[model samples]
Target: MQHKNTIKLLFLAGITMLLASCANDDDTAFTPMEFTTPTYETNLELLLGDTLKLNQEILNLPENVQFKWTTEDTVLSILQNLEYIPKQAKTFALTFKATTNLDSISRTYQVKVNDPYDVYYRPKSSESSSLISQVLAYNPAPGQFINSSFGTPEDAQKLVGSTTNTISLGAWGGSILVGFDHTIENVADAKDFLVYGNAFNGLSEPGIVQVSFDTNGNGLADDTFYELRGSAHADAATLTNYTTTYTNPGMHADVPWLDSLNTAGSVVVNSYHPQNFYPLFITELEEVSYTGTRVFPVVSNSGFTNIAALEWGYVDNYDADYATYKGNLLDIDQAIDADGNSVNLRGIDFIRIYTGAQVNAGALGELSTEIRGIADFSMLE
Candidate 1:
């Protein structure tokens, strides 16, 4: 009787072990919840006021899972899909979460909303001239002609109606803003505009050109400006968002300037230009600041210092006589945004030109850009 009781105990112990092994196998076979999508990051882009649908198909999640989408403190959607329309141009960070009883998964999306396309058609009137009709703004950095010849806002107006008149944009960052009565179309496979400057064979003071559209129909150049990508634009030496501040020395002296790179320099005073280098028209502020793209100039000193011209895409940059129509021709298709990405602009209503170099050529003084006039190329065609 004792042996039978022992045998029964052993059998019961074996059965219990078998049941535990089966339970372990079941747990091992269970699959963990995970996103089946190939990539974890998603990017969506749309224009402002346009509906962007975020369908559940993008998740590739399993059925019976709960979904939640949130941006900041606001819950965008609790459903499996979302339809969003942005009111303004900005970026939005969105989070999508899927949860079940035992597992959860999440994803992030960056939604970039851009402004709607606004194109200003050219006017049909025969009286409209291809040249710029108005001077919107002018600000010249400290240079030889700041207070003497071409620093004031009124000096920018001289180039409006005639190709013979000229204005000097003082040393680096000096800029002029001008607008046309009609928009200049970006014709395919052809240059769109011409900018006349005093650039000749051995003297080239290139100016960075930027274009803007009247997106709001406000008849103002208050919209975003895109830089025209020049030959040096892709060069690693080129600097973007460069800033220089000029401090008034209170006399006709070397204009001291500090740059964003923590470097310091001066717009050396020359005997030919005895007037103050600092702009005198700006009385409200003692110091002036200017910022834009800066290019590297190749300065060679033989008998005289000569600044070499870039291949193309800059005002006051030398070009072959046949390639120019009394000025340097520019293509509107080369427009680029702040991030160095190319942008397709239908047309432009305003143009801004700024001195792009900051070299002080020994006795020649500071390098400056001189603009005679700007004209729409379609008129010539």
Candidate 2:
């Protein structure tokens, strides 16, 4: 009986020791797993001409780790080697994403760039409601078929100038020089100014618009002028470097014009607008000459044939309608040197628009390209 009690006591002690070992195993298994990801700064400030360097070192990321960087500003020029350079003054938002075997993380950075040139001139606030501040000159000659009143010199301001209200232009090569109270800056990577004209369904009257900078700082418009070439300037149907001469019809005769192709057309007298299309500024001139790009006018059995709206880059396009007008946006980058190479311009002070097409729409009379108003493109945005 003594020996049996001794064996049972030893077995109970062994069982206690086994339970304690199982408890130790449970405590060791309960430890949680941990995860980690890379991080970086979330804000940055830059100047107009400064460059931002992007690399794993700046991010304090581990070596051999791959990451991606991107920005929302189109004006920024990104180098293939990983540099962010802003071309203009604006706030840019950048995103950086990094991933690892265990997890991934993302961060955003706000970059504000300051403009060195600052705001030289503020555009008129009321683009659609504002009238052209000034009209410097008006020149229109009568067409053999197109005879209408160009109004007086005072009336000329209302004649080819831009307005939110309805206005008319003397048919033929009626040209006008319009000015603004402030200069128009050449915005980077964006359109500078917009040309508002009268374009209806299937009928588009194109005009040649030119720009000039106050380079001489003379406040006057005697500076060099650059033509804002339109979309049709390069069309195979267009006549580039073309020249045409118009001889005055005198007091009561038809106007005649001759083109480079020797294809002659007459401006016939129509009963539409009673005012003579000839300019009151110039008279009894032997001949008037026009040299530049010309857009072809369409005439069909149903009336004027529809001129397809260009993708962009032309004034008086189909977008000129009152309901859809968004200023015909033009970029200063489109300017070209006399050799046809691109020319860089800082800003413009004066604007000139001329009747670009020598087209007659039969009963419609001469295609009188009309202007409603001009506005800085930024105003629409």
Candidate 3:
């Protein structure tokens, strides 16, 4: 009986030792370790003539990592042929994404080109209400907003002494937003030259033309900006008083205002308006109509908006018409093929329908800030 009790005691002791060993092994195995991503620093706001520098460093990262860079502005880039110039000052961004097996670090640099000196800009009215009056207040020496639809660049010269944008629209679509570049030897030459364009007949909807100024050289417009849109006003003749007033502040509003650019005149707007434009739709583009009232057809499957604001970059190699007048600007619609592939884009941001596109794809992101142009200050002027 004693021997049997001894065996039982020995077995109980063995069981206790096994339990302790299992508890200790479980405690020792529970060491939590993690990896940390790299760190980078860049100038959040850089002006023209400023050198863009990226101070990058890694922390607790494995070797043999990959580094890639991307940019929203085609004129500026890294490890690519695109040249960097601050002409037509706007906001642009560069993203550096470093990836490793364990972790990744992504950094962005916000660059502002062609920033204007305080004295150069005026306090204009809001964009939503009085587009024409606000734009005119900036340089109200003595000029008229000539519709390029009715006459030639010469006519603009005859009316305002300086031609604004090139003539793009026909007799109905109003004038292109172009200005003068020629000098007269005799002070009496053909008052204006002309700029022709393609997609004139192909466009089902009206086009957009924005007015810009090169404040700080660098060939970019960096200061306050105004937009002009000319849509077919069925009763434009009977309408004598046409005005628009943007009611937002800081260039963004919940209800989009800046989408519909009028063709010079046809529609009337007032100066009391604040800024109102769709941020995603930045380009003063010709509205293309495929089927009906909307510019683009809604995709049935992906739930994308039919009319989308396409992000365009410089096209130096383009051989189309108006290439000279348009310069290296991003000019066409960023459309995806039927096969569900994206267009070749230098840098595209928003993918939703702007106020003008006429289709509602859901809310895409706001367009890059560079395209917003400088805020209008002509009100103080």
Candidate 4:
């Protein structure tokens, strides 16, 4: 009996010790680890020639954990999962996988590519396969000077429309145009732009009128000029007074002696000034012919009656920033004379019509005012 009891006790002790060893083994563990993907925000839904960044944060892993990266076949790459770039574009499926210590996690990212000048050209018209197409509408560069080239940031904010007017007094069947260049550096789209021009031509009226740049930016009559008689006379320097008249087939762009002042085939833009030295030049052609005092009546909400057609005319002819005049044309048709003949349209382009006419509602006619902007068409090729 004693031997049996001793044997039984030895067996029980062996079982207890085995259980304790197993529990101790269970408590022994490898190093703990954790992982989390990085997070960031993109300023745009679509990216073009721009760059994107991926920000990540790691956690609870061995300080010496190894990192292996893989990416898609694309124009640009982060080479690692942190930042992947889709150089060109695609409705792409992209994935990123991270593996460490036998534990792996993955994520995906997507973005679209688009033109920055979308406001002016979206779903492009047949007229423009490029990023931007022709933009119409312009304002005289405040104090526009002659023989000089200059631009403003306001000139880059293009104007968009489904269609343009088929009729006008200046340039007919308006076809918008613009060019861009900058004087300073450090721009968002360096390939963006700096200068701008807008123009249109009306058939038989204002045949051609275009905004051009001299490019020197000095506000002096420098680069582009008209050779009149012999000397290269800059177009305009002051804005106090200005006039435009077409010259006959007489002058060329370079020669001056043969320059035609009248009865020729070139345009003469004359300007008056007091403080400025550079005159602004605008290319034009012949269109409408006129003789008798061409009257323009102005009408506006302000109840003024005896206003004359002048820029700095009446005291109450003021509004937000500048004075504007609009008129009801009692007559502006293709005039036929007493002989049943098209009043032989003589002057068919921009002409120096006297501005001393009477205003309708007031004395000066009502003017149409709008926020002027320019659109570039280089991308529409």
User: Against the true structure, whose TM-score is highest?
Assistant: 1
| Cα error, candidate 3, residue 285 (Å) | 18
Error of 3 at 304 (Å): 47
Predictions ranked by lDDT, top down?
A: 1, 2, 3, 4
Best by lDDT: 1
TM per candidate: 0.71, 0.59, 0.22, 0.27
Off-target runs (Cα >4 Å) in candidate 4 are: 1-45, 72-81, 110-120, 123-272, 276-381
The sequence of per-residue lDDT tens digits that candidate 2 reaches over residues 1-381 is 999999999999999999999899678543222223355566777656568876533333443444667776332322213487777789878776565444455557787776533433344454433335677776654542233333445555663345553234444455667777666778899878877776766666666777886654556778677887666677789766776677765554456778777878766666555444444346546777666667765545364445545445666666433336644667877887555667677777788777677666676666666666787665556
Candidate 3 per-residue lDDT, tens place, 1-381, comes to 999999999999999999999899678543222224444345465455455554455554445566666776332343312234455456777676666555566677776664443223332224321111111111100011212121233332332321232221221112222221211011122111121222111121123233343344333234333222222212233121222222222232332222224422112222332332211221222221111111221123255322222222211112232244422122212223323233322111111111112212233221111011111111112
Of 2 and 4, which scores higher on TM-score? 2
Write the residue-wise lDDT of candidate 4 on 1-381 in tens digits.
999999999999999999999899679664444436455342335544345555445566554455443435542333333454545544454454445555655555555655332211122234532222333223221121212222222332233331122111111111223322211111232221111111111000111112222223343223221100100011132111122232222222211111112322222222331222111222332222222122232323455433222222111112111212211111111223323233212111111111111112222211211122222222322
Winner by lDDT between candidate 2 and candidate 1: 1
Question: Worst ten-residue run, lDDT, model 1?
Answer: 116-125
lDDT of 1 by residue, 269-360 (tens): 98998888887776435888898899987888787989988888998888663145667899999999999899888788899999999989
User: Which parts of model 3 have CA positions greater than 4 angstroms off?
Assistant: 1-45, 48-60, 63-150, 160-170, 178-210, 213-216, 219-225, 228-381
Where does model 1 exceed 4 Å of error? 1-119, 321-323
Clashes of 3: 63
Worst 10-residue lDDT window for candidate 3 reads: 134-143
Q: Can you give the lDDT of residue 276 in candidate 3?
A: 29
